[model samples]
Target: MKIHIIGGGNLGSAIAVGLAKNAKGNNITVTRRNIGFIQHLTEYGIVVSQSNTEGISEADLIILAVKPHQVDAVMAEILPHITNKIIASVLSGITLEYLNKKVDGTNTVLRLMPNIAAQFGASATCISARTADLPKANVVTELFNKIGTAVIIDEKLMDAGTVLGACGTAFALRYIRASMQAGIEIGFDAKTALAIAAQTALGATEMLLNQQVHPEQLIDKVTTPQGCTIAGLNEMEHQGFSSSLIKGIKVSLQNIKSE
Candidate 1:
């Protein structure tokens, strides 16, 4: 598949890296105002350009990774050239309806929500489009699956998915940082503390993934009555760990909705 990614910023670069790594023989183009920073992508057979119209004109799939506010300008630049190809927008809070209006409803539009983990081929991406666009949507779903897990969801849930999957990456990292800090306070050096916290987090996540069990089930297994594990868990809860996480996700969704 020929793919053009507009905006070679962080998320766009990550997506290009993941796709280039996993999907050989596919022609990929990444566009930005300054192409020098992402010129290295050419080593993987990906093209780097500063022209949005040129990128859009050359690809079968156009992935818009531009800022939400820049979408209008990009659309205006490319609208005259776009044909019936599928267009996927990674911009947060940009609706399919808005895109369709901008393009005069000629193209099949999709909304994709993926995190920075895309660079590691481990993103949890959400795909959404109108019911009539399912055929093209599935093509996108398969494209994203090359980099990570992809789920088809109602457009209404895109904001919630952004919170839990995109912002959730940062939340998980913050928890690891906190754990590492505590480990350091207990005498471990910074590197060892980071290793311990990161590996522990990976193990915990693997357990949940492989076992297909509720988190509380694993918690019960780890926490015997009056055990240190139980004590620490309770302390975290008391300090509003879970509550704060839930509140944070809610706020993120609210902010997206407001936008």
Candidate 2:
């Protein structure tokens, strides 16, 4: 696949690196206003372009990784060159209807929500597109799956998925940071604390994935009657840990909706 990612910002660069690492005979091009910032990507045999039109002209898939506010200008720049190529956007809050309208319905559009973890090939990406574009959408799903898990969902749920899967990455990291802080308070070195916290989180996630069990089921197994785990869990609840996370997610969704 010849993939052109417009906007070599954090997300765009991460996706480029991830795809390059996978090396599936894909020719990847990434663009940025300041090309110097992403020039290193060329070391991985990824092309770096400063021209959106030039990049889009030679690609089979055009990924819009630009900011939501930049979409209009970007679409204008590439609209004349766009053909039947698959257009997948990683821009949050940009609806399919908006994209279609901007391009004058010249392309098949798919909205993707993937986090920073894609750089490490562990992103949980969500995808959505019009029903008529399912075949192209599946191609995108497969492309993202190379970096991590990708699920097709209803377009209406894309914003919710962005909060839970995209912003959720930061939420998970914050919890890991908290665990490390607690470890430090209890006498572990910073490095050891970080490793323990990260590995424990990874193990918990793997268990859920492998067992296909509910999180509460695993919580039950860890929380013995009158145990320290139960005590800590209860304390976290008392401190509104879960409530804070839920509220945070809701706020993120509202922000997207308002945008």
Candidate 3:
């Protein structure tokens, strides 16, 4: 796959590096108005350019990772160069319908919601495309799975996926930060507190993934009769922990919809 990624910002550059490191045999080019920022990608054999259309004409997959407001301008610059290429967008709030409209319905447009963790090959990417484009979508999914997990979902849910899969990274980190703070108050050093909190969160996630069981089942295992775990959990619940996170997610979805 010859991949050309436009807008070499954080998310775009992360995807470029992730793909370059994990998916071999694919030529990748990343573009930014100021290549100085992402020039380091060359070490991974990725071509870094300042022009969005530099390799777009030859790209099999053109990834749009620009800001939502910049999509039109970027699309205008490269639209003439695109043929039947697969255009995958990682921009939040940009829908497939809008992408199809931009490309004049000439290309296979896919909306992908992936977080910054893509750079470390740990992103949970959600992909959506037209039903008729499932085969191409699956191919893209396979490519992304090399960097992290990728799941195909209905386009209608793409915004929700953005909230959970993309913005959720921040939410998870905030939880870890809170845990670290608690750990510090409990007598651990800052570094040690962070390590414990981060590792504990990772372990919890791994268990859920490996066991494929309900989170409450694992909670039951940890929350023995009148245990500290249950006590803390109850306190957090009483303070609206889950409710706040749920409301935050809903607000994020609403913000995207409003845009």
Q: Could you estimate the TM-score for every candidate? A: 0.95, 0.94, 0.95
The residue-level lDDT of candidate 2 at 117 comes to 87
Ranking by TM-score: 3, 1, 2
lDDT of 3 by residue, 1-259 (tens): 8999998999999998899888889999999888899979999999999888876878899889888899999888888877899999988877788888888877889988888888988889999999998999999999999998999999889889989999899999999999999999999999999999999999999999999999999999998898898898999999999999999999999998987
Q: How many residue pairs clash (N, CA or C atoms closer than 3 angstroms) in each of the candidate models, in the order given?
A: 0, 0, 0
Model 2, 66-118: lDDT tens per residue?
A: 98899989888888997888889999889999988877767788899998888
For candidate 1, give the lDDT.
0.91
- lDDT score, candidate 1, position 63: 91
Find the 10 residues in a row with the least total lDDT in model 1: 51-60
- Model 3: weakest 10-residue lDDT segment is 50-59
> In model 3, what lDDT does residue 83 have?
87
Which candidate number maximizes TM-score? Answer: 3
Task: Report RMSD (Å) for each prediction in the order shown.
Answer: 1.5, 1.5, 1.3
Model 1, residue 167: C-alpha shift (Å): 1.1
Clash count (model 3, backbone only): 0
Better-scoring candidate (TM-score), 2 or 3: 3
